[model samples]
Target: MEQAEIQAHQSTYEKEIKDQLDIPLETLWQDAPIEPNWGIKKNSDGKNTFWFWFGFKGHLAVTTKSQYITSRLMTSANLSDSKVATPLLKKVEDQFPEHFTTAILDAGHDYEPIYRQLQGDQMGAVIPYNVRNEPLMP
Candidate 1:
């Protein structure tokens, strides 16, 4: 009920939380043996409000090179995960444009508008298409 008590409690809480995160913190930055994928976490506290029942979506940018999350964004408590990746990608790109030269993703990131945008840049993406009809390397 007093400022001193609150301050002491806050400091203890902070230290406790930091102490709890040691393993995951180190693991998050470890070098990876394989590429990673972007994710959308479905927050389960929602949909229930509307009688449907779904949670939240957490959009994250993971480093395929390091298997680490470079960045993330928690969408409005009601938005879809798919709806967040694009904006989140833009945010990540704006913050670290140098990190992406050739961005490769699954069919999802191959949106026509996005493809056109990436095409204009030096981004070499392996999007889905009629590769069968395309010329092979000589």
Candidate 2:
């Protein structure tokens, strides 16, 4: 929500919060309109390519039985895990509502727009939220 919407930029990341603004934004994600960001970072076992680095975010959903990937999405190297996830879930819901009515997402999935859409659509979604931002608890 930095208001960088119009610009054709994507895959924004930094080593430190202090270093956030200085970087030149070299890459663009495969998907446009990426909102929230999520991914784990490790320097390839600390090998330090230094040349290569971006968040690796992917979507893998399974049935309650842990049998198979009900639906999955492998995002471009640099994009928010949450951004890719919501759309995938929405698509699944749209195409096969009978197969998927309720969805459970990790705390990373807690975003205002996604949450609102799920609620508005009357879809069951279990989303874990960050404790500090817990509006429902108090």
Candidate 3:
């Protein structure tokens, strides 16, 4: 692609993200609506990997040493896991301030805002990269 084309694409993408972020976070999960969760079928090649189920997804923040849930949130399966991290962490922080020092999470929680929140809370975030959403090198 030409330089102009790349710049235009980036500009459009940034605008779309800003528009999405403008929506109130609370409204994002005000209702428990059935949504699709995409899953890959086992023993299938990349071409036929897609499958889904309509349901809700449960997210939990647990105490590492005690194995007890400190916070939880449920949302439509379609919701991105990254979207719930900050809220869930906030809840944990409110209830158990200074109780934990690190958050271990999967690649789905690999988002800039989530990391920023963790940093602001004086906590460490151990999350892998979501290749589809981020550049390989950071």
Best by TM-score: 3
* C-alpha local distance difference test of each model: 0.46, 0.52, 0.65
Candidate 3 lDDT tens digits, 1-138: 996676566521122232223334354335323455543333334365565756677889998899998988876666656667766776677677887899999876777777777876689989987676765786
> Tens digit of lDDT per residue, candidate 1, span 22-138?
223223223111223333443334453323324444567777799877777653344433333344445556578756776556544444545544554446666655343356989
Q: What is the lDDT of residue 14 in candidate 3?
A: 28
Clashing pairs in 3: none
Task: Point to the candidate with the largest lDDT.
Answer: 3
10 residues in a row with least lDDT, candidate 1? 11-20
The candidates, ranked best first by TM-score, are 3, 2, 1
Residues 1-138 of candidate 2 have per-residue lDDT tens digits of: 454552325333322122222232222123333343443444434574454445444567677766577666665555555555545555555555667566787776776666665664567789876563466755
Q: Rank the candidates by lDDT, best first.
A: 3, 2, 1
Candidate 2 stretches with Cα past 4 Å from truth are 1-57, 132-138
State the lDDT at 84 in candidate 2: 54
Against the true structure, what is each candidate's TM-score? 0.44, 0.53, 0.65
Off by over 4 Å in 1: 1-53, 76-82, 129-138
CA RMSD (A), model 3: 6.9
Alpha carbon lDDT at 36, candidate 3:
53
C-alpha lDDT (0 to 100) for residue 126 of candidate 2: 90
Steric clash pairs (candidate 2): 37-80, 38-80, 38-81
